[model samples]
Target chain A: MSLPNPSFAPIDWERATPATLLERIAEAKIVGMGGAGFPTAEKISLTRKHPPNIVIANGMETDPDVNADRVLLEQHLNEVLTGLRIVARILSAVHSYVVTSHKKTIQVAQGCLNDNETVRYLKPTFQNGAERELIQILTGHVVKDNRFPAFDGYLVLNVHTLFAVAEAIAGKPLTKRLVTVHDETRWIDIATPVESILESSDPIRVGCYATGHRPRVNEVLTATVNAISTDKSVHALPCIHCGWCDEACPRDVPVESLFVMAEQLKPNLDAQDALNRCNDCGACVVACPSNIHLLDHVRALRQRNDIEWERISRATQARLRVDAREQRMRSDVIRSDTKRTERMQQQHKWQ
Target chain B: MAVTDRPKFQTTGIMVHVVIALLPGLGVGAWFLGHKVFLVVLVSILAAVATEAIGTRSVQTLRDGTAVVTGMLIGLCLPPSVAIWVPFVASVSAIALGKLVFGGLGKNLFNPAMVGYALVLIAFPMQLVYLDGLTGATALDVLKHQETESLQQLINHPAFGLVGAKHFEWMNLAFLVGGLYLVLLRIVPWLLPLSVLLGIAVPALVFLPLYDATYSFGSPWFHLFAGGTMLTAFFIATDPVTSPSAKLPQIIYGFFVGSVAFFIRCFGTWADGFVFAILLANAFLPLLEPKKVALDN
Candidate 1:
């Protein structure tokens, strides 16, 4: 119920060295809690080679309908900003930003920003939280789809990661976070049994209804998970082919076609290519008038495609092995012929 | 628990609304045709529900209310003077042969209502027509038989109204109101219905000059208001399950149905062209949205 102040002391920025701060961040074992769960230490470690880098605290909270970031920013605004400053110091960031979709979070962030730091709000849309999308929105610079923003002198950290960084600087590891369980928002301990979060016979989504997956058996709460939605699952009705899912899709994926393929349980190469464009934003799930859980079908299609990928790769490898062996045998036959001709010539000379 | 983001209606909800919209049209059809219209509609609904219940043997499938809509559409498409056995046959064929045989509801290739109507229309053409039986007797039939009348004399005929067929004009207005309600709810795509109306009207206007004043094929307004033109445009042709989903595809599909219906009404043997027009359009569906392995974009 209480904010985890634990006798909080403001960081002495003048005395904090970049190497030591990075070590403290590493010691905390903090991670991006905005669904990806990427290790913060490893992420920041890569951005060191490129200077004049920008640091952004991603309070955007792209996990559809999840309130973890909003609540965290509301209660722990100082800590989140402190974590951002701590990351900024490590790389001597030229500029720092606190980006969020929540109106109140942006207002709170703006009130406490330093000279080099700025805060802005984005009109929340599906995939607005993705790295490339965020980069495109804020900087007006389109990053190549194949490349990562971190490699291009950008450091985007989830607000929860920043909060953990602040706590890490205060000599605490990331052990707990604000999680939305059903409708309740509170600090949940990492590794708590997921079943304990909500008591529903229906399948539970580990994040929000839009983007969360059904937890595996005995799955526990992790830093990446910000919500545990239960009692939301329902039987999918037949696809009326209304194209609502396609309209809702931020990536413009042909979700109805993909869903049809998924239902047939057939592997399709075209579906595989289309899946690459889909970020699994769950917009389609929200848009379906038939209450079809399109994300489930999308995931099913993904699994099918993955299996198809393995089969294709394995066949290619087998063909390559056979071709190499044939080439080696031909080369060996040529070598033996040359040796025989040399031996015959030597015998003729002796005669 | 579902985050109904944009006022989403489930399949059952959509079907319920469709049934609601059909009521006004049903009432008007019954008022114009006679008490037999009520009996025919009731028989069709009961038969369709019974067939569906027996076919699937599931109460849950019955709850979706699609059978009811199909029954209503088929009932409205038929003449009120048809024999009692006719509605039963149409309903049975609609549910069994038209819908369930193709794997039920959403998987149906053609509009179930049109399939049943077309079947009965072809099988017992005399029963469907009953031309001389009733005084009002459908405007299209009256228009077909009146070849010697001049344009001015045709307008004075009891079968001809200001713009449309005599009794059918009011019936068309009722159906239009119901359709507009559906469009307001956004259940039926507006573009599809609009395109169909334009499809029929544009050609009728173009062919207005070619009319021999002495020969009667009726005016463009008569064609628009008579028979099942509005019904097919708004309700039958716009059936989302049988129709294309995208805007462009819907436009093309609607236009094809409308133009074909116009041609058939003008030249074919049938009094109304919608039943065959819609079925022909259904056969062309795969071309509009080909089920290719890859749907680029």
Candidate 2:
């Protein structure tokens, strides 16, 4: 299960201080490779403020179609572990864990684990891939209800992000990443034009098919891109009202009603709550018998909600400005009237 | 990395499955009622498709196959002895007035088949007479007309079969099989059919024992197996467009339809009241569906 050659030259651990490591990560501009794209340096710094108790390397690829993390774990086990140790050292974390469900991935990771490091296996599911959910699984603490894992003295980094961190420490800028395109996992350079990878005229999805966006043709691969795919058009049909989407949703979000609301463009407040709760995991789409692109509807509804929010905010700002101006003008007029009356009174007393 | 949509099931596939499940019932209906049932079904289907295509000005909707389903359902509800033109008119009305007028397909509030059936029932009552006048009474008609006869005597009547009304019981059995297949496929929700049966059976069970020689009512088995009970409960009443989609609402809606239909059959004047019962439930769908209620508030 281990990689054939773990001959990666060891990082100069004795010479590299936490400050220097943080500086290098910030300079490389490495962000979360888990697709959130939050800067790794900032996340480390935030966790360092509280001196995290644990650092978890998230290798759980819950998206059934995406295998970039699994492949990275298999191919670059040493580099991923080095990155995990580096983060642990910088955050002054007491214990570090590599979280994965894949047996081979865990075995490879276990061969390279240090004294403070442990391998934790979690059964892969869509919810387990989420940072909050992963923290809950590993620590038995629900961070999602109130605060983030980092706020609770835990730092969770994606395995791919740790790989990028290792490369950044080895003096490579954040550039190339493993991306699964057309079911083949390969190292794709960042900023590679999507058109170069897309071989067909099919719609280009910028991530896994389930949660990926239909990227414009001119878009380029980025540090966060885990998978790219050409759209295989599902022969979609009208909804049969089967309610499988409702059953499949992890958050119990009432996806069937959300679909109807999204289609009709008449989403209510309850639908808004469903939209917020949706993680866009695409499980509902997978469960749908009609092949409805349910995530697309969810995204569309969210975008519409965002636009509506923006409009209301803009209108409120404009009204506030007008009211402030009107008050100022009224004050100015009253001052002028008082001065005129005082001057007339003075003239009358002199006469 | 194969970027196909997650779920591979197509809406057309569901419709195709539903149509396949219905074949057994159609076959039974044809055997008992003769080839005219097929003719009526064919005419209704063609008329419905034509109305949808011409009214909506879109031929692509035919691929979805809902029009075909609506047409077939309307045709099945018709009396085998009904004039061919009656189904044609009903099919056209079912698609145009019942469906298209409500903005077509998923937008419609009423079950198109039930709407068309109710329209034709009111307009052509005399022409809707069944079985070539051989029995002169359907099971519901017999139950409604019963006076000074015991339940046993009613069962021994010429219109009555061992299980239910003559020839109708076999058709009902075929439909029950088809409906179960639909439920197994998960195309139709099980709650609707189960609740509908309970809705009818519970009431009939409580009422049948009260039957005296002066007021004869059919047994629960006879009611369940009788004319249009299985067909309406499984096929017509469970139409997604008209029926409530959420679990609790769907159960309540099914129960309401079944109970009202039974009440109409036992005490009301209609020979079979499924059409009216379904229509009445359809009217309550917005109130029953949790989503619609949330939206209104």
Clashes of 1: 0
**Candidate 1 — which pairs collide?**
none
Provide the TM-score of the second chain in candidate 2.
0.94
In terms of DockQ, the best-performing candidate is: 1
| Model 2 docking grade | acceptable
- Candidate 1's docking class is acceptable
Tell me the tens digit of each residue's lDDT in model 2 across B162-202: 88888899999999999999888777888999999988989
Which segments of candidate 1 are over 4 A away from where they belong? A1-14, A61-65, A115-117, A231-233, B1-6, B130-135, B148-152, B292-297
Q: Which regions of candidate 2 fall more than 4 Å away from where they truly are? A: A1-10, A13-15, A101-124, A144-146, A171-174, A232-243, A254-272, A328-351, B1-8, B56-58, B132-136, B161-163, B290-297
User: Alpha carbon lDDT of residue A64, candidate 2?
Assistant: 48
**Tens-digit lDDT track of model 1 for A103-217:** 8777766777789998888766667777778877777878787877778888888888889888878766677889988778999899999989888878778888777888899
DockQ of model 1, rounded to 2 decimals: 0.40
Compared with the true structure, all predictions reach lDDT values of 0.81, 0.82
Error of 2 at A197 (Å): 1.7
Measured by TM-score, how close is model 2 to the native structure?
0.86
For B20-121, candidate 1 gives per-residue lDDT tens digits of 888888888777678788888999999999999999998678877889989988888888888889989999999999999988878888889988888999
